[model samples]
Target: MSSTAAGSPEPPSPRTVTPAVETVLAFVNTRADGTGRRELFEDGDSFADWLAEFGGFGGFGGFDGETVATDADAAAARELRDALVTVLLAHSGDEESLGEPLRHAERHLRRAGSLYPLATVVTAGGVELASPQTGVERVFGTVLAAVTTFAGSGDWGRVKACRNPPCHFGFLDRTRNGGGLYCSPGCGSQVSMRNYRRRLRQES
Candidate 1:
């Protein structure tokens, strides 16, 4: 939230989920993670179902016992997720095609766009006008907006993807050196050692 020469500050950036956002994101990313493959977006039915139940931000098609059972394939999920995030989260540099979490990202953005309002007005008439109402879509929009704002404004240059190759989770890389790559210090150490070992073997 830096100030411009006009003596006014820019709008705050979107960011980490506040319990509410977390709940929705939890449901959203789950399909992509697929809990290590037990559940997956393998087809249209599964994907559509997943979107309806969880991916929809708890409101895509309404709550029901239906599960995503589409013949869509893994690639479809990956694609959808990535595209959604691309729009929902600003400057999300995650445009890779058919990654592991593509469709999840798409579901995320759609619901976000559907729910979260970019701006809310608070008139001076003692009225508190709201932008994002309550729901899954709102949650996604707010969280994604926070991420997008941070990237757009270059807020502390903090937003980053995990350096751990195996765990490519995105986060606000809050490190002093701003070089924190792995999601955790332990992962960073492991990756460093692994790289060093590989180099040693290469030299031999």
Candidate 2:
């Protein structure tokens, strides 16, 4: 029975979506906060609620009442999120810092499932990706498809993680040079101030 914020903007129409980048955005936004401490999918019930809300917003289907997420699903989802965070950090040029998490992410990603092209239909839009699975597999498949397609389209570098700790939100870098390093100007400013204070203390 949870609802969107009181003044939240309406989600874009599903028909207008290009799922590649949008799906990745949706998956990453599931975290209640950029800090990763509050997880939207902390359990089966919570996962179900998130799936319901996210599915409606993203216009994704196949995860209705019939799909049953388990405790294992919650665990896998968290693991995947952590792995993604590690990858984002690596993307930010810290590849040497999280080798093990990256490896774990790779293995799990390998098992996520596969995508096959669906016949293009004018009504349904042009050629689209589809997967023949359900439950957690479907979730993994959708996210992986987004990541792969986005990377193939050369937008891989545009997906970035905030440099600010405890607020590592994944965002599409729409900057002219794709040099964005934080989730928002606020985060960037906070980091800047913190760094400035630290340096001042060192000098003092």
Candidate 3:
């Protein structure tokens, strides 16, 4: 295989995520340089752990001339992570029917109505970047801030909850025609079949 020939070799495909999924993924993947973890939303536990860490601080209150109790910190972290996951996971449907993890996630996302995930700010070498301000970070301060870059932009059309029951979570429909409705194509087919069966039962 040559370096740059289709017949010789193919370049690696790029990893792509729509703006909506990226929002939640960002929260799930934030890294804490203050701690050992170097990346955020890279994995599930880390996402949960970041919430734990963020919630540790009491309402973003910095340790003043006096330091706060360690237990207070832990409690705060728990609240933020749990709240974020909870708000995001809250669904219009029967939320109680969801699995434990899904229930937790829906709870985290419910607050976001037309606007999903929300946004904040992060500075580059000099310029600042808009991002979601994960509430915990604002209370104590953080390198990244929650942002609402996607709010009220008439871009909400792409935002969609996956039709697949298993992944009923939301994602931005990124097909050129903006027709994407599942996290992945396989799930789309699964959902279509499910809907088909549902219609058949109703018709019968």
lDDT of 3 at 46: 42
**Prediction 1 global C-alpha lDDT:** 0.45
**Residue 35 lDDT (model 2):** 50
> Which candidate, 1 or 2, would have the higher TM-score against the true structure?
2
Q: Residue by residue across 1-204, what tens digits does model 2's lDDT show?
A: 011234566533322335566777677756656554567878987887777777654435656655578878887777676666667766665445367877876766656542322221232223345444566666776676667655655557677677777777877767776677887899999989999999999999
lDDT of 2 at 153: 56
Output the better candidate (2/3) by lDDT: 2
Off by over 4 Å in 2: 1-18, 32-37, 57-59, 65-67, 94-104, 111-126
Query: Which pairs of residues clash in candidate 2, taking residues 3 or more apart in a chain or in different chains?
Result: none
Please provide, for model 3 over 1-204, each residue's C-alpha lDDT reduced to its tens digit, 9 standing for 90 to 100.
Answer: 012223544433222343323544334333233325454444445434545554533223332323233444445434444444333333322254347766555554344322323233333322223323433334322311222223233344454454545344545555776556465788768767888999999999
Instruction: Output the number of the TM-score-best candidate.
Output: 2
Among all windows of 10 consecutive residues in model 1, the one with the lowest summed lDDT is 122-131
Stretches > 4 Å off in candidate 3 = 1-21, 28-48, 51-147, 152-154, 202-204
The digit string of per-residue lDDT tens for model 1 on 88-201 reads 233234344245455565566566466466554344332221335443344334444544434444542344444444444445544555555555787678778998999999
For candidate 1, the per-residue lDDT at 89 reads 30
What C-alpha RMSD separates each model from the true structure?
8.1, 8.1, 12.7
What TM-score does model 1 achieve against the real structure?
A: 0.46
State which candidate has the highest lDDT.
Answer: 2
